[model samples]
Target: MMTERSIREAKAGDKAFILWDSQIKGLGAKIFPGGEKSFVLSYRVNGAKRLSTIARVSELSLKAARERAGQELVRIRSGETDPLERRREAREAPTVNDLWDRFLTEYAPERITLGRMTTGTLKDYRNQAHRYLLPVLGRMKVRDVRRTDIERMARIMAHVPVQRNRTLAFASRLFTVAEHWSLRANYTNPCRGVVRAREEPRDRILSDSELAALGKTLTSLADRYPVPVNVIRFASVTGFRIMEAAGIQWSNINFERGCVTLPQTKVGRQVRALPPAALELLKSMPRINDCDFVFTTTGKVSVAYKHLDEVFKMVCQKARIENVRMHDLRRTVATTAAGQGVGLTVLRDLLGHKTVQMAVRYARQADSAVAAAVEQTGGNIASAMGVKPKAKIVHIRKRRHG
Candidate 1:
């Protein structure tokens, strides 16, 4: 008898009352003055009358709520059953939120995923859950959730496809943790068949002119924004992710070996060798006597995230570079290093990529070098076949200078 509007309007007075379903005998929705509505089934336990809540209004649709109430009524009428205790025991089943707590406390710390879970990963997870999962699936019992729920989450489109894919990935991992926790009613993960948004690999790299401009801008900002400039220069050569560079400590730097070691990294924690240029830049940076961090104003751990972002933005604006993020420096380093004939293994280690395939993905800005190699091969082939090499034809487009 509860329509959406009626349920919304339903309020309790000074006294409590159940608005029993007209069609169903004992099935009713209990309303409290506090505005909580729940589907409940009234049945007799032994000789005593007992009422057990089926589910919350938000958790189940009206039809599904009635159906659950009906099921509870039928179960009680059937010969030897304690419906109250059964539902009471069923109350112990964790909701998605509860399982999420357990996931953070138990599953994540053990590094159960494909790789090590960093603090940054946990922070991302916490933020993703805060923004996405808990808001959608908080009320649903973890066991009761079907594939459709996960599909619903995946369907939430973002302006960028990466955000949607990341939400899906976070959901998938939650389901995996739920499965490992053995909390799901169905053994299969809801995330398995759900189509996630495709993510394009970011290919932002600074050109020679842009790099020169950036260097000059950083040099100018050295007095005002000393920490970020040095860190930015360090990352340009070392390919350090913003967080990796942010987390750099004086103790991690091995000047003798010309390297910086990250005790904990996104992938496997490893040492990254610095070239003479990066080493010289590191040496040039003035160290604070009491501070342990390579980048800090308070001499605590590192510069505040917002401070780093603001300084970087200011530097970019000063450099006259449009649409350049801090991460592009890492990509620029990788592409430049690869073009300079740096080996894949060295790139993999230097960039802290878990695999060579990931390293290879970063080493993909060698079109000119590759074209030159192909030209040499073609010339050698033509000479062996006694064919004369054709004269090169070049086309140049004139730029409009302001």
Candidate 2:
């Protein structure tokens, strides 16, 4: 009599037709009907034998079948299991969206410690992530995301360069946080290695003709909106952001000293001296007893963001300028001063940049005045020689040349 154990082992490599049927041990392997290369294993699970595929002895070697059987035996002993069930559980786990929410709550507040972000900027980050990234990749496991996924996302976003670049940057930052926080085993920034779309430069400055048109538009806006006009004028002169100009208070200004002190900026607290034009504008506006803000919408300390949006857009349209943002007006201030021969270090301090490098961008826009100053004095020695400038040259030669 063939032993059951021997019969099971024989099923591994034997091509001969064999079959077994029993209740407890259940039905053993059998040649699949109408096929020689396929076999069925009728095995017991939870007191009932279920049939599962075990490839033909001719196709899958005896060693392979035994090895697979051993692995399946481990699963069969684990109470209840199915390949599809295992896969489904993996699919339902928390994903990139869950982590992004946690990260924004935990990381941003601490890292962005200088102060709160502007309401507009916060909304922008939220909308970009939600609208672009989360819908596609949010359900995928953060660990499962590979460089290829990032590259593909970037390629798809090639049409909208700036926003696309930002979305990729946000994804990169998210992975960085995951690595830093130990949520991931490896620190893989999917966005790190991939090439991104070239970010088009935005260094918009109003030309003289554009400024003339803008001035005309401002005249009309000033007639309709006094507080917004004051804010706009303040922005043009002082290089303060719209919110910063709106938030300015009487206590922050020292008119006698000709200075405006910002307790908080996008970067941090910064101090800027009031220019004569800004001073005159401030002087011309009637001081309101109801509110302390130098510029207010409705006797309140804050200016409505919407208050200036349309007016600024109207000015841009009237001027027929393209891609000119509000912050570009601030650039105009730095550009103006740089053209007036202001030193980079002085402009850095005037603009209240934390570092000199931030001010260096405007350093390039420095006009003829800087070059003129350089040409007016050939060298330091020219100033030293009051009557006649001297030309001096020194030369060096290597030993081989000599």
The lDDT leader among the candidates is 1
After superposing candidate 1 on the true structure, give the runs of residues whose Cα lies further than 4 Å from its correct spot: 1-82, 110-115, 368-402
Give the Å error, residue 298, model 1. 1.3
Candidate 2 deviant stretches above 4 angstroms: 1-93, 113-121, 249-251, 283-293, 298-301, 304-307, 319-323, 368-402
Q: Local error of candidate 1 at 53, Å?
A: 9.3
At residue 128, give the lDDT of candidate 2: 75
- Separate clash counts for every candidate: 0, 0
Worst 10 residues of 1 by lDDT: 393-402
Candidate 2's error at 335, in angstroms? 1.4
Tens-place lDDT per residue, model 2, 20-42, is 43422322345433444343455
In Å, residue 276's CA in model 1 sits off its true spot by 1.8
**Cα lDDT of model 1 by residue, 285-314, tens digit:** 667766878787777668766788898899
TM-score of each: 0.72, 0.66
CA displacement after TM-score superposition, residue 82 of candidate 2 (Å): 16
lDDT of each: 0.79, 0.71
